[model samples]
Target: VGNDTEPYKTQKYYGQSAFPSSAQTLTVLYNDHFKPEITTSFETGFEIRMFKNRLTADATVYESVTKNQIIDIPMDFSTGYSGAVLNGGKVRNRGIELTLGGKIIDGDNFKWNATTNWSRNWNKVMELPEGIDGQQIIGTGGTASIIAKVGGTTSAIYGFGFVRSPEGQIVYDNAGLPAYPEEIQYIGDASPKWKAGLTNSFSIGNFTMNVTIDGQYGGIIYSQTHHKLSEQGKLNSNNMGRETGFIIGEGVVQNADGSYSPNTKQVKTADWYTRYYRRANIESNSFDASFGKLREISLQYNLPKRWLKNTGLQSLQFSIFGRDLATVSDFPIYDPETAALNGDTILPGIEMGQMPSPATYGFNLSLTL
Candidate 1:
């Protein structure tokens, strides 16, 4: 079928227009002039097995291109409308995945098997509509915003950052406190560069055990909870220099002649923490998303054949399972996996007021006749 413009014209009856003319004064805010976006993708991979199927490996590489991306653009007051959307952007995404498995120990009485999988991804914006630099903020969650900028990573975390001089030395204001960037800058990449998971299984006669460990690396997450708590003087980092005389910042100051010298100024303990925690920048509030977790474990046993022979049941098994037993991460409070706003919104890495994932432990029983 041919492409159609104004695809939603027939759906306009559901909004303000549905009411009688006397019921309201203000009506629809803007016209819908957007079209459906298109995405093209390609994927290719290979798998190999050896040692009588005891060892196996596979890898995949994929690329996807999104064209005519639709985004809600802000409008000026003179237009008498809040916003208008157009489709005129492009982005490219590519990634690779790898999987490996092997039966390390094979025997009649005892057997052990292990498997691991890994993945990596990269993405960037290629184009945008004319007259637009292709910079758009999709959402503001917590202290950072999810932004898309041409030639930058997709849905990068954008927010204020500490001002740094050309020599990468921290810049300070007249108050002897750190200064913030004049505009929002790329604070961190929300997406992970690499991730991996490993699983191990053991079997001895009718008894079995399984364990899984998983990790994510090379990413950043903004923690709104930590920032707010620190501001309230509840965090340990904020309390460290409380009884001390003052806190000395670590950086060199740039002189008028472009020479750098160590900063000798000291800021009040409370004032320093407050300023940095409250208005410093996303980098201060950001934490590494890299973490490893004991993802899952289980133990199971089947009844002896002789014991079940007299019973009507053909087989019986019992098992105990646990998930998310422990995690090793520098990020405090809620899990980094928690998304303040999820579903359809591509911006990630900003967490605010979200609950932590609960650990689960349970028993399972099965019977067959």
Candidate 2:
């Protein structure tokens, strides 16, 4: 069920009109409203085909729940007013999907084919409205801001880190670093827990080949392209270097019979006017949960039906392709799939030279008449 209504008008005058009959103004203000929403979903799946059928498989699982949720909420303009749409809230999403097909060989002059797919997603915000416990929903790519929040959990990573301590802990800054708190650091969970794809094909007699691969797992990427390439140093000009020294482990700060100190005035610094910029480079460079091969291998040819059998042109084909190409990851810098969940700030994932992810060797042609 769903419904909605919106209308607005305004005009007010109390000063300056020098006489239109001593000027005094007021115009009709109209506002009408209605909102309705309700949704529920559940899905199940199955599929299988074997051997003779050339083998095929499929699987699925899904869940969705949404209610009310018409958010616009956020207004206190010092009492100025202009912000309203409310409807409490609720959101939930659960998932699983898998697919596979095969035909390793069909033989008739030689043939082979393959396919694969995978997906998994989970999102939740359950409810919100009432003093707003923590609200934010993904942002970062250069200033749409946000960066995570909203019932959080999934290993959160919203942006601008280190500033905890309301019992949350993580505040430090006498010089030992880590102590940002002007605001920012939505913290954790950049999405992606699983996603995958694979493809393969081959042909003989006319010659053809194709291969593909893709992956994304566990999620969490806030490298802001190595924090804007380590703040302009250009991150060693893409060599991406950073390990500047001074993060002496865990909340750091010892000696009182705890040992570990190399005189920097007996050490204990960390607080350069709120622990260095961009919240300590987003809590010390974040990266993990990877598995990218993204794109790969392709080759093709097909043109020989007795050279298209007298121009009737039955078939013809050609191919070549490449992209982003390769990545395994220990992540020293660059490649984290160039990170972007979508918060569009001129294409986020700011790493400076900022335009990697290109490796195309393109060529394609197809004709059949």
Candidate 3:
């Protein structure tokens, strides 16, 4: 509410082992005018069951607007401080969610149930604090960054891209390399367009089974992993023209008369791969981050009451399950669902050498007396 200060001390040693202590201050300054963030929201939903509890549905639509967002804004060097924490901006979010559940089979000793959930959200930056205009940097990931721009999604990514001709064709340089703008441009949004999940459960006699699947549709990610692998020739596509010693670039080139022509320059095999997949070339590494995953599958068995009566026990259950078993997507790398990690923060739409998602398998046993 007030300020942040670190009681830091340093020691200065003299020639003859005499030491003096000096106090140090941090680079961040706390603003006295900062206030707590406030959010005003409205939500409406309905839950109903039809056909005598055999089918159920839940629907919700909500809108929320947040004001006075707490943020750190960079300060001028003359201030002797790096940044200041202030109440900065406003953001709006609108979304809808739907969930449906059904009891497909209802019989003695045998039963089955299925459920599905779907949700979609739209996020926009309504306004920025006074003095800041156009856009503000929210997070950074290597050569790319997350930005909150007015009228745009909150998780918009800004990065460099290839310079193209009027016809929207990539314009290559005489060296057969792609050309980029002098400044960063809007790439894409990291927020997924929609998400959905399905779950199925079945029980027959003393045995039960469950299966779950989930997926995210739409959104893009700048993958440093893909570029690093391609640059090092670790990817299979990098093998092109390796034996032939040279690779031909594919793009249009500006001619002498201000017109365009097909590029025919042949670059060295090593040079083509290195420059084409360079870390700063965001266009080549960015990919659609949509994917469907086999989230989980499990089977369980319970001891029958007739058998448990002799053991002086009330109930017992044993189950085995597997999680993150598989994925379906056009993503070139290990997992499409990834985010850039900075200290304790995780920023989406940019991947920097993310570890593969784990596949877990285990069993469980339960008992009661």
Model 1 TM-score, all chains together: 0.87
Q: lDDT of all the models against the reference?
A: 0.79, 0.59, 0.85
For residue 209, what is the lDDT in candidate 1?
99
Candidate No. with top lDDT:
3
What are the runs in model 3 whose C-alpha is more than 4 Å off?
1-20, 310-312
Ranking by lDDT: 3, 1, 2
Off by over 4 Å in 2: 1-44, 50-52, 55-57, 62-93, 102-105, 125-150, 159-181, 201-212, 217-220, 224-229, 232-325, 328-369
Candidate 3 has what TM-score? 0.92
- For candidate 2, the 10 contiguous residues with the lowest summed lDDT are 265-274
User: Is candidate 1 or 3 superior in TM-score?
Assistant: 3
Error in Å for residue 145 of model 1: 1.3
* Cα RMSD (angstroms) for every candidate in the order listed: 3.5, 21.1, 4.4
TM-score of each: 0.87, 0.35, 0.92
Report how far off residue 141 is in candidate 2 (Å): 20
Model 1 is weakest, by summed lDDT over 10 consecutive residues, at: 1-10
